[model samples]
Every structure is written in structure tokens, then in C-alpha cells.
Target: MTANTLVNSKLVCVALNDKAQLAALEGTFNEAPYKKPPTQPVLYYKPRNTWSVDGAEVEWAKDFDGNDVAEMVVGASLGVVIGKETCRVSAADALDYVGGYTVVADYSLPEQSYYRPDIKGKCLDTSAPVGPEIVAADKVATPDSLSVAIKVNGEQKSAFDLANMERSIAELISTISRIMTLQPGEIIAVGFAGDRVAVAKGDKVEASIEGVGTLTNTLGGA
Candidate 1:
């Protein structure tokens, strides 16, 4: 809701089932680790610098190949906002800690591996654009399954449903809490199971999740 409210909170991203992408990388790199999909939630952090509100501009400039203004992989996802301190919670009771849900665009530079933290790729300024509003958890008809879509420059580029996620919202919360404590106001980006394509400067990107909300951001040169 406010930057002050989220000062100490963390933004965690989860990968539900990225087998196809992983396998593709394995072939390109001829590596063993990418041969199979991860069994658990593959988590990464989007630090405070990445935080932005809906309608904000997401700037990108670092090009890994050193050509052109860098494009980003835009991930449309559901964001679950934590309402209370959570630790070792059970899947059955995980919803109790949720404050609400919002739409988040998880942006990052194109990456080949998830083996190590890609701080430069993901933790960039305005990489995580969240919210125009927070729909109280109880308002969402079915948190587990919702239609999600992404558009760049007014052209629809990707579409999918949250129902395709490998884990339920509660299960994800239960699983993540066992590893680290989640504080109030923190957000868990429940993962994007759809296509994530690169977008360039001046592209107006919009990511929306059914029943939750929609977030719009303009990609600009850094």
C-alpha cells in the first residue's frame, strides 16, 4: 500500500514448474542440472530497489551481449501479501496469514540458469511492479486458479492460468515458511507459468491476473 509499510518486507519469486525451459537450457549448455525440473519451489529475491507501484516505469539498459538497449523477460504473476508474521505454518492454515492478493510483473534480464542468484539480471530497479490495489484475500473467488495475461505495446504476447501451477497457494506458503520466516507486508510472487518474452524500451507492458488485479508499466532506457 505504501513504501513505508514495506520497508522491511521481502519480495520472493517462486518457480512452479519450469521443466520445458530448463530442458531447453540443458540442450543449449549441455549441462546436467538443467536436465530435469526442480521438485520444490525455486525461489529468488527481488530486493527493495526492484519495487514499483502500478503505472510505474521499469527501466532497463544493461545488455548482456552489449548491443541495443537491453530487453527484459516479463513475468506476469500473482502476488500474495503477508498480513502477519509467519513461520513453519501448515498448508491447511497458510491462508490465515495472507492479507490480500495483487498483480505483479516480475521482470528480469534473459537468464540461462537458475543455479545461482542472478542479482544483476533480476534485482534491477523497478523489476518488480506491483499493485494498483490489494484485493483482500477473501474477495478472490478461487486463489488457486485464475486467468493471467501479459501485453507489450498493446499486443497480447502471453497468456496462461494460475491453475497450472505445480503447487497450491497454501502449499507454497507452507513450503516457503519452513525455510525462512516471512514478515508482515512481505510478498510472495506465486510464480508465472506462462510465456515470458523480452520487451524493449518504450514498450508499455501490462500484466494482469483475473480477480486479483492488473499492473501496467512502461519500459524505458536506464
Candidate 2:
């Protein structure tokens, strides 16, 4: 499916699934009253209000001081589209249910605290930008090691390698399927590593995955 059809799908993102991100939050998760690392992936809702498409120009949140051209956090990640209704699938068989992979740029405000749900920071209108196209599973040779680079205004801000993911993409799919059934067209945004890139208003943000294609968005005002 294309980016325009992503609006018909549901999205919730997985966090701390990357080595860098998990390491960043390790101390906090270890220090909490619970005093232990989580066995399951940390998840957050990216409700319908947050969905957008490639090249979409979205409004700035009130947190941006009503300016669209301000620095916002952008995490470029790989999204796995569920091919069929899946529940309790094994990692070995998970790929059988994958539709394909697509580039996902999940935007949010800065200063997100991992201690609680970041609804205000994450679930804003057009915060989740999906696009380019879905590259078939068999088409991508190295799904585990895809490199994603983020450039703002044609300048590279950060480039993250998917090789550092704590869980293999298939493993995440299998684990998630055990808890709840995922329908066709549903998306699971695999995690991203490194700090979220900061992009200002009018910045041209491009998240490119060589063979997979690029998902580009420019921050603009209402």
C-alpha cells in the first residue's frame, strides 16, 4: 500500500528496541520503583490524528509557539506492514505474515520523558509521516542492516544503522503477535537508534533507505 492508504491503517510505535535508545533509558528503567528492565517492548499510541503522508505539510503544535519552522524531533524508522491477521506467530514464521517494509518518520516535541505516556509530545496531528512505497519483503536483501540517514535542509543531521536493534524485526513481530492480533494494513514501526534529528520549520527532511526509497517532508506553516 501507499502512504495515502496509511491513513486507513493503525499505528503504535515500539521504543527502546534499539541498543542506543535502550542504553539511554537503561538507568531510568533500572532505577525505577520496579527496578528491572522490561521483558516486553515499550509501546505508545500513534492515533489516527497523527497520521500523515509523504510530502505532507503539517501544522505546528501549540508547543512550537505557533511557528511551523522550529526544531522538532524526528525519528526515522522502518515500518512493518502486517500482511494478514496474525496472533501467536513464531519468529521463524513471522516473515510469512509481513506485507512489506516502508520508511516511517515519527515526529514529536523535544524533552519526551520515558517515565510516562508522551501523548502530548507524540500524538499530534500529522506527527506520523509514512511514505515513499512499501518494498516487498523478498525485495530487501538486508532488512536487519538497512541504514537510514536523516538530512535537514540537505545537511546530514544523523544516520542510524538498523543493525543495532535489540530485537530482530521478525522477533518483534512474533512477540507482538502473541499478545494481540494485528490486522492487514496495520503498522508496527520498528525502533530507531541514536538521538532524534532536530528539524526547523522550512527544513527539508529526507529519510532514505538506499534500495527501499526515501520519505521526504518539508516543515511549513499553515
Cα RMSD for candidates in order: 3.1, 2.7
lDDT of each: 0.78, 0.79
Q: Model 1, 83-118: lDDT tens per residue? A: 899999999999999988888788887765677788
Instruction: State in Å the error of residue 222, model 2.
Output: 8.4
User: For residues 1-222, could you state the per-residue lDDT of candidate 2 as single tens digits?
Assistant: 224546345885888777877777777778865478788888877888788888887546665466443457788888888888989999999989988888888888874567778887887788788877888878986788898888887888878788888888889889989878899888888887558887676678898887877888877652
Candidate with maximal TM-score: 2
What RMSD does model 2 have? 2.7
Q: What is the Cα-based lDDT of residue 147 in candidate 1?
A: 71
The regions of model 2 sitting more than 4 angstroms off are: 1-3, 64-71
Residue 79 displacement (Å), model 1:
0.1
